[model samples]
Target: MNKEYINIALADDDEDDRFFFTEAFEDLKIKNRVSTFKDGIELMEFLEKASLLPDLLFLDLNMPKKSGIECLKEIKASSKFKEMIIAIYSTSSSEEDVENTFVLGANIYIKKPNDFEKLKKVLSEVVTTNWQYETSGLNKENFLLRL
Candidate 1:
């Protein structure tokens, strides 16, 4: 399948998890860029200064600097990034966490897979579906104008 390269940001504290996700992307052979942040505060800071905002964000529920729920609330509250696709990519399977994330305006909630095969499937679905917003021949300038 022909796929456009998309920029993605990931917010998670665990080093091993980060490495695993990076590996999963590599294994999938998806054309994309992935940026990583250890916490919500750092991710927010990057967003504020970043010239190129990510097409998708994968956020974890637990972190040291700021919680994912708090970050989600802030992102949803902001008009600047309101249209950006934010997904809750966490280990939590709690109903409350899922409900709250959606209420806070997350586009999707995905549990972190335990194995490489599951992670590969998750990555494939994410690239093929959730991140595939139709541009419909609109360039960045035109898209921004329409927005």
Candidate 2:
């Protein structure tokens, strides 16, 4: 699983958001494979039996069918996905949402940016970051609460 290219997945219902996400990755010119799921159920189904899981998974909180919180809880409870980095990518930046996801074992929380350039920057930073090392250095005071 130590491949050169990073495996990235995004689950968001908005078509424009998904387009921007893919476009950002392409514009960055990074060596990575990106996958998009419209809802939580689709994402869960893909990951449940997939041989190789994405190194990073970006989840949008508000969606039809199942919410990100539900997906996050399910993913965190499973030992098989302990290595996967879960980043909460949502429009809402509520403190409650932030605290809940953090407590639920999300690796990071990124508030969706309105500006396209900012989105690109955020995506780039998240993709380049060595999350394993970051998590090892994670403290209650300096948790991955926001970006």
Task: Give the per-residue lDDT digits (tens) of candidate 2, residues 43-73.
Answer: 9999998998999999999989999999999
lDDT of 1: 0.78
lDDT score of model 2?
0.90
Taking every candidate in turn, the Cα RMSD to the unseen true structure, in Å, is: 7.9, 1.6
Best by TM-score: 2
Can you write out model 1's per-residue Cα lDDT over 1-85, one digit (the tens) per residue? 2437878899999999999988888888778888999999999999988887887898999999899998998888888886578
Estimate the TM-score of every prediction: 0.84, 0.94
Candidate 2: regions farther than 4 A off: 140-147
Cα displacement (Å) at residue 93, model 2:
0.5
Q: Which portions of model 1 show Cα errors greater than 4 Å?
A: 1-4, 130-147
Candidate 1 collision pairs: none
